[model samples]
Target: MFHVALTGLLTGLALIVAVGAQNAFLLRQGIRGEQVLPIVLTCLLSDVVAITAGVAGLGIVLERWPSVLPVAQVLGGLYLIAFGIHAAMRAWKPTALTTEGGASLTVGKAIVLTLALTWLNPHFYLDAVLMLGTVANSFGEDRWWFLSGTLLASLLWFFGLGYGARLLRGLFARPSAWRVLDSGIAVLMGVLGVGLLAH
Candidate 1:
């Protein structure tokens, strides 16, 4: 069980702690002290449902229809590349992250955006539904335990990011830091995207 849980946590972090739309939005909100409760819950719950679905049976589908996975891979790769480009653009032309001047979205708008970020992105499906599911299957009967671990990782990350971001509020106040972080995200996303296509 420890092994399964540890595997789940580590693997979960590997997938969850990436530069993506959901994460970036969460960080921004965290810094702003906006509608954090609803947004954090939405993100955490979204991951729970997605990761659970992936572990439940998506892995089986991929295993049975090998052809399906390649398509997912291609789509995921393209999406990542596009996401990377967006991040790169942000890095190049970063706006000052001002607590006072940024758009203060309504609760409804925050929830709507959170949902869109989580569900609309094809990469989310590839990661939470296909890739994680595929990885969970390797644990055999212990896959559920692995799922739990993965779930915990997501749980921790969202909470940590949502709440912990305040600590970095000072650091992110400067545009240079944001630029560097965005640039790093762009590189990471680009590399992962290219790796997917190459594979």
Candidate 2:
């Protein structure tokens, strides 16, 4: 059981730790100390749903009807492009983070954006749903244990990322830092978006 759980935890971390659109957004939120809790919770819940659905056989459904992936890819690609454009605009007129505050986003808007980023990314389903699900089931009777490990990993990672970002707040106090970060985000989104579309 320990081995199974460890495997699941390690596997989950391996797949999720990759720098991607979702992580980037969360990092930005964390650094700014803006709506961090809601965004983190949204990410955690999204992972739980996707991972659980995968274990429950949603992965198989997707595999059987492979056409679903392309549609997701196209939509996700376009959405990412649009998001990138927004980031680029922000980068152009970068603002500094202050101890007092910085740009503000309503919790509602942030959560909605979080959901869109989470659900619209095809890679999320591919990794969390299809890949993780297949791996968990391989453990047979120990599948639930594996699932537990994965969940634990998700919990730790999201909280760590969201909260950890606060450590960088000081570094981002300069408008120059904000410009660099936003520029990077824009580039990342564009690359990922085009990659998705081309796939």
Candidate 3:
């Protein structure tokens, strides 16, 4: 059981550590210091759902559906490219000292955007659900223990990412810092999209 739990924890972290839209959004929101708690919780909850589905064998079902993969990949790729372009455009634009003047994003918008960022990516389902589930299968009935560990890992990571940004809010308040952060995100997102296309 301990081995299973350890494997799950590491696997969960490894799967999530990649550069992707969801992580980019979380980082940006953290920098912006807007609705951090709700955003983080939503992300974590989303992970919970996906991970649950994967552990429960839903992932295997989805993976076997050949028609779904291409469409999902296309949509996910397009969305990533669009978001990357938008972020890059923002970086190119003049910076304001106080972004607080802009209209804050509503909870509904945040939730929708988060879902798109997370669920729309076929790769997300592939990695977190399908791949992880397949691996968990090796544990037999002990897969439950593995999944519990993975779920806990997700909770820890999301909370750390969401709330952790608060510590750097002062730096993000600086125009130069914001510029660097946004530019980095733009570059990361663009590269990820390009990689997806190549794959």
Candidate 4:
């Protein structure tokens, strides 16, 4: 069980650390310190449910019906492209951001955005729901340990990212820093979105 859980922990970390909409948005919210708790909680819970659902057997459906992936890719790719453009525009504007206090988003808006950033992306389904589920089931009865590890990883990353962001408050305080960060996010999203569509 220890070994299985450890394997799942490492694997979960690997998958969650991917460059995606979730990370980008988290960084933004973290730096701003706006609705951090609610956002983080939402992300963590969403991940838990998604991972649990995957382990419960959603992966089998995806594997059997491969066409679902392409459809998701098309939708996700288009959304990513649009999001990327928005980020790029923000970069162009280059607003100064402060971790202590700044323009805070309403809790409702934050929740909606969080869900969209998490659930709308096809990559989330492919990686979190499909890949992780398949991997967990491979362990048979030991699958629960794998799921636990995944849950732990999600907890650590979300909390660390959401709270630890304060450490970078000084850096992100500058408008120039926001410009650079947003620019990178924009480029990443645009490229990945295009790749998904092309693939």
Which prediction has the highest lDDT against the true structure? Answer: 2
Query: Which 10-residue window of candidate 4 scores lowest in summed lDDT?
Result: 94-103
Cα lDDT of model 3 by residue, 7-106, tens digit: 9999999988766789878877876777777778888898888887888898779867867877877788777788888777776665433346334778
CA lDDT of each prediction against the hidden true structure: 0.79, 0.89, 0.79, 0.85
When 1 and 4 are scored with lDDT, the better candidate is 4
Superior candidate under TM-score, 3 versus 4? 4
What would the per-residue lDDT of candidate 2 be over residues 1-199, giving only the tens digit for each residue? 9999999999999988878888999999998888999999999999999999998888889889989999999999999988999888888863433433446889999999999898999999999999999999888889888988999999999999999999998898887888888889999999999999999
Ranking of candidates on TM-score, top first = 2, 4, 3, 1
Instruction: Please give, for residues 134-174, the per-residue lDDT of candidate 4 as tens digits.
Output: 99999999999999999999999999988888788789877
lDDT of 1 by residue, 1-199 (tens): 8998999999999988976767877887787688988999999899889889889887567557767656756766777678779768877864533543444779999998788667755567778888889888888899999999998999899999999988987887787777776787688768877876876
Q: Score candidate 2 by lDDT.
A: 0.89
Candidate 3's TM-score reads: 0.91
lDDT of 4: 0.85
Question: Alpha carbon lDDT of residue 157, candidate 2?
Answer: 96
Distance from true location, Cα of 99 in model 1, Å? 0.6
Residue 178, candidate 3: Cα error in Å is: 1.0
Model 3 clash pairs are none
